[model samples]
Target: MNQQNHFALGLITLIIFLFLLGPLAIIFVASFEPTSVLQFPPTGFSLEWYRNIFTVSAFMDTFKLSMFISFLGNLCALLLGIPAAYALSRFDFRGKGLLNAIFVSPILIPGTVLGFTFLRYLIVSYSLPLEAALFIGHTILMLPFIIRVIASSMANFDFSIEEAAMNLGSSRIGAFFRVIIPNIKSGIIAGVLIAFLESFNNVDISVFLTGPGLSTLPIQMLTYVEHYFDPTVAAISVLLMIFTAVFMFLIERLVGLSHFTKR
Candidate 1:
């Protein structure tokens, strides 16, 4: 009976994995198709489409813009989120629950609603530039994720060590910098990865925030698909997959992906 149950679970896992990976497998093959249209079972294979992505000026600029926004906005999120998470984990303060709910509320809201709110609040009210609008929006969206990840790590942390340090010679701030931060390094790294990806791939928020000169790569890809139907996008998708794989590989190497997976 146990053997049968184990077999059933294994079969279920295989089916789910295949279901998720099937489309990605098709796209990987489609990207190499020499013809213009994206199709399975290509007549021939060529690197032409991959080469074509670079020739498009907007793709290059938009890619750079996406990377910049994702990295910088995530950095700001970490700067704000780490301290916020630490405080929430360590201290008792007035309105702590309310503040925690507010900090994490964005994760519960739909991205489209948040985007519209930002447009009305920042652009219409404050007349902020597109760049600033996007940066701030991404940072806000990132905060909840960063806070959650780091906060989980903090929960498992041994606060006694920090207290011991403080009882000795270290100031509270010094104890945090020297001991607490090092202990939670895995969570910080995980948060950085998750936040950067969210910022890069976000569409609903970025759609409203984009202006005349500034557009994220995902939005740019949408616009490209509207005017053109070809394997160029597939090629781009393959490249993004490769980029994501490399990033994940590095994350696994540095901190072990299990850090994020474990409760």
Candidate 2:
């Protein structure tokens, strides 16, 4: 009976994986079609659509902008998130509960609502640049996930090691950098992957923050799809899937996927 139950669970998991990844597989196949229109079974395989992705100058610029924003936003999120998670997990203070809730509040709020609020506050109230506002907005969106992942990693960590480092004459800051961070390195990498992907793929918040010149790759794809229906978008999607898969493989290789889960 136990073996039968295990088999059933494995079957269900496989079905779910296929359901989620089916469209991506379809898009990958469609991207290679020789014909201008998107079709599953290509009349003949060609890389024309993939090559066409570069022909659109906006795609290149937006891709660069997306990479820039995601890198900065994810970095900022990590810088803030690591310390925030450490404090929340290691310290006790007044309003700690409130502060923890607030740190992760962005995840609970609707992205569209957050975007609209940022638009009003950043532009109407303070007149900040679109790029600056977008950076801030993406960082806010990324923080909760980073904090949550790192905090969970830290929860299972043994604090005695940090204390041991301090007893050996290491300052508190030094102990953290030398001891605690290395222990939670897996969580940091996982958080970075999640945060960067979220920032890169975000569309709702980016839509509000984007202007005439600055736009993310996702927004650019949306704009292109609005006017055109070619396989170039699928080609782009395939490339992004490859990019994301490469990162995931790296994460698995460096940290092992099991580190993300609680023991």
Candidate 3:
């Protein structure tokens, strides 16, 4: 009976994997089509789309734009989120619970609404640039995830260690840098990775924040698909999947995925 159950579970997993990955496989295969139109079956294989990607300034620019936005957005979220997480984990204060809830509320908001709200705030109130709008939206959207991850780590951390370091004549800042930071490194890495992924793949928030002058890769793909029904977007998607998978593998090796689980 046990062996039969194991076989059934294995078959279930295989079916699920195929369901999820079959479309991805199709995207990759379609990317190599020689024809201009996006179709599954092709006349022949060609590298023209891949080659043209290098020469396409719009594609290159959007790729860089996405990378730059995710980087800066995650950095800003780290700065804002660490303090908030530490506060929640290490102290008791008036309205502490409320503050925590408010900080993470962005995650609950519909991306479309959040995007439009920030876009309105930036455009009408602050009159900020496109890049600033995107960064602010992404940073806020990712802040909760970072804070939650860090707070979970800090919850498991022993404050006595921090106290001991301080009692030994280490300054508060020194203790933080030496003891606290090292202890929370895994959580920090996880937060940063999650933040980057959120920023990188965001479409709804980005769509509202984007201006006519600037476009992100996802938005650019959307724009292209509206006018041109080509498989270039599929090719780009394949490249991004490869890059993301490689990075995730590296992250898994660096910090086991189990580390994110609550203790």
Candidate 4:
């Protein structure tokens, strides 16, 4: 009976993995199709679509823009979230719960609604530039992950460490920079990696905020799909999958998958 159950569970797990990864495998194979159209069990293998990705000016331009937004947005989130996480984790204060809720509201809200709200208020009313709007939207989107991850790291932290550092002649800020920050370095890296992935692949917010001459990679991919039915997008998807996998591997190496799983 035990062997039967174990075999069934193993089979189920395998099926689930295939279900999740099957489309990715199809896309990877489809990207190598010789013809322009995306086809399953590709007619013949070729790297034409891969080469075509570079030839498209829009893809390169949007790739640069997406990279810029994702990097800067996560950096800004880390800067703000570290202090906020420290405050929430280490101190007691009035309205702390409400403040935390406010910080996390972005994740709770649907991206489409949030994007529309930003478009109406920031773009139409205040006349903010597309770049500025995108920056702010991505930053806000990242805040929840940053704060939550860093706060989790600080949860078991000993407050006395900061006191000890201060007693040793370090200032409050000095103790934070020298001791607290270094201690939670893994958490910071994890948060930034997660947030960067989120921001880079974001389409809902970028779609609304994007204007003429300013678009994200995901948005451009969507546009490409609408107008053309080709394996180029499939090739792009394959590259993005590899990129994401590499980042995930890095995160696991730096912070350990166990760190997140334990939380």
Top candidate when judged by TM-score against the true structure? 4
Task: Write the residue-wise lDDT of candidate 1 on 27-122 in tens digits.
Answer: 999889998887897779999999999999999999999999988999899999999999999989999999999999989999999999999999
- Of the candidates numbered 1 and 3, which has the greater TM-score value? 1
The TM-score that candidate 1 achieves is 0.92
For each of the candidates, give the backbone clash count.
0, 0, 0, 0
Tell me the RMSD of model 4 versus the true structure: 1.3
* Candidate closest to the true structure, highest lDDT: 4
Ranking by TM-score: 4, 1, 3, 2
* Model 1 spans with C-alpha error above 4 angstroms: 1-9, 253-263
Estimate the TM-score of every prediction: 0.92, 0.90, 0.91, 0.96
Candidate 2: residue pairs that collide = none
- Per-prediction RMSD in angstroms? 1.9, 2.4, 2.0, 1.3
TM-score of 3: 0.91
Better of 1 and 3 by lDDT: 1
Local accuracy of candidate 3 as per-residue lDDT tens digits, 16-114: 999999999999999998889989966689877888777878888998999998898888889999988998999999999899889978888888898
Residues 1-263, candidate 2, lDDT per residue (tens digit)?
99999999999999999999999999999899888788887677999989999888999999999999999999999999999999999999999999999998998999999999999999779999998999999999999989988998899899999999999999999999999999889879988997888889899899999989888999999998888877999999999999889888877775566766543
lDDT of 4 by residue, 83-156 (tens): 99999998999999999999999999999999999999999999999999999999999999899888988986
